[model samples]
Target: MALKWVKDNALNLGGSPDHITIFGEGAGAASVGFHMLSPMSRDLFTNAIMQSSSPTSYWAVKGTQETSARVATLAASVSCPVSLGDALLPCLRAVDAKLLTDQQWTLVNRWFDVPIGPIVDGAFLPSHPEDMLKAGDIKKTNVLMGVNLNEGIFWIYSFAANMPLDKEGATDKEQFRNIVLAIADNNATLQTELLKVYSKEFADAQKRRIRILDAASGDSLFKCSVVDFARQYTELGGRVHLYSFEEKLTSNPWPGWMGVLQGYEIEVVFGLPLNNGSTNTQAEKDLTKEVMGLWTSFAKTGTPEFGEVEWPMYSTETEDYVKIRTKGTTVARRLRSHACAVWAGHQFP
Candidate 1:
């Protein structure tokens, strides 16, 4: 319908139908990636930009069983029949919108699990998105994809109260392994391997456990998925541009230890005011212009060109991407490659 409207009335609305760019951040980015895969969405857009999320990310999808379980929970919360008999759609629609939303949030706010997400219904998405990308089923549109430096820090800190951080703000081996296991779908073997990697690398006292786990979470849940998708998509002959936002956040309202947590790039990318409610700094302004320039340039053309760095098309050989920072941006490769390798076949839940 969106494409139909654009085709019929874009010119009348003073927009070019042929130049549409589907842009999304986080979950919306996952949506854009799906559109890239769907045959129905082919040729609907000429370009796509996905930030802070990827089709390969675990949180981007859920099995049908889990999705159905959440639906049953929601129905029970609203005092509707779980079976719904012949009134399934009506029963759901009859629940108060606010009540349904509150119930959904309650289910979603739990640590180590996502209560809801898109599922593979075997039509639009016939198989796992990872499989589709590897099969080269996605539309051959220009693509831009990336994640923040510390994407999982926000989740770890947000759920700190429920997590097993000790008194001095550290976690023991048991607590750390259990946390990883919860996300890994209770796969003990995978959690054991992850523990070995993180423990060997950050073999200090418990004091540094929080920081160590933060990077582990980011790599397992975000960064490695980004690498896998970029590599696989490129292998299938897709033109891809990758990035990692590593600007040490200066005006963060949270503790300094939060690093450059997830979604920080949205404000920077869209030119919004900084977290301190000030955008007067010349450096911030320059960084904002550079990000927007690259994005808009990709929308108009099919490539990103910003500052002295000409963002290269992603390939398995270089595996390079533009790293955004306040000082300057440069090309980097294989972020946390060692930790990412431990998570190669262990993505679960």
Candidate 2:
């Protein structure tokens, strides 16, 4: 309805309905993916740009049973009668909005679990996102999608902050093992595979553990799904230009460990470094301009190609993408092939 309203009023708003470009970052990007797959949203947009997300991402959608359970939990918490079925809506609506928002956090039980998200609704989302993509049921549009180099670091930071830790104030070896087991759902085969795949050669046990967790979390949560989406979409004859955000700015406020964290690209994409009060370096300013140019060019022309950098269309054959950074943008192939292979058929909980 929001997209429809925009299309309906584009002329009065000094925009063109024929050139609508729907773009988003993180969960917003996932929403863009859902729009592409939803029949009701077909013809609503001409192009899309998804940063650090995919419709098929594990946490992007919830099952009907799980969603119902969450709703019941939320209703019960606010003194609403869950057993009343249809009566619950009015009761929930009567509760204070801020109270309900605060209680939603209690629904999250694990590090990567998202209690509230899109579901397989009969209308907006007719089926699983993976099924839709594989069946070629999605609206074909020029798409620019990619993930950050260290997307999982943010999760690691969150886990360390929220989850219980040993006296050393770090995730011990046993704690790390247990987290991996929980992530693998206690499947012995998967546990072994994960340990083998994420093993690091670093001599320091703590450093090795952190790096392994970072890689596993990033791959399972973001990188793999984005790659899989690109492959599936391209297989269906959809044009896609994939990318990897590798730039880490000196002005970043987060700990150095959180390298190229999720949502970091937003500032650069919007040319924030060029702002009047920004402390970003000249190089960052230049990169911001280039990034803004790429984004705007794509929004206007359905292609990100600008200046001397040639971004080849992503495909299963080439698996090509441009690595955005301060040094210089370079073409890299087969992003995380080994890690993606390990996560290929398996769905993370």
**Model 2: ten consecutive residues of lowest lDDT:** 161-170
Cα lDDT computed for each candidate against the true fold: 0.77, 0.85
Q: Write the per-residue lDDT of candidate 1 for residues 180-264, one digit (tens) a residue.
A: 7754557778777876787777755654666666777888777788778878878887889999988754555666656788888
lDDT of 1: 0.77
The best candidate by lDDT is 2
What TM-score would each prediction reach against the true structure?
Answer: 0.88, 0.93
lDDT of 2 by residue, 57-133 (tens): 88999988888899889889999987747899899999999999999889987677787888998899999898889
Scored against the true structure, residue 261 in model 2 reaches a CA lDDT of: 86
List candidate 1 stretches off by more than 4 Å: 84-86, 105-110, 162-174, 200-207, 274-280, 347-349
TM-score for model 2?
A: 0.93
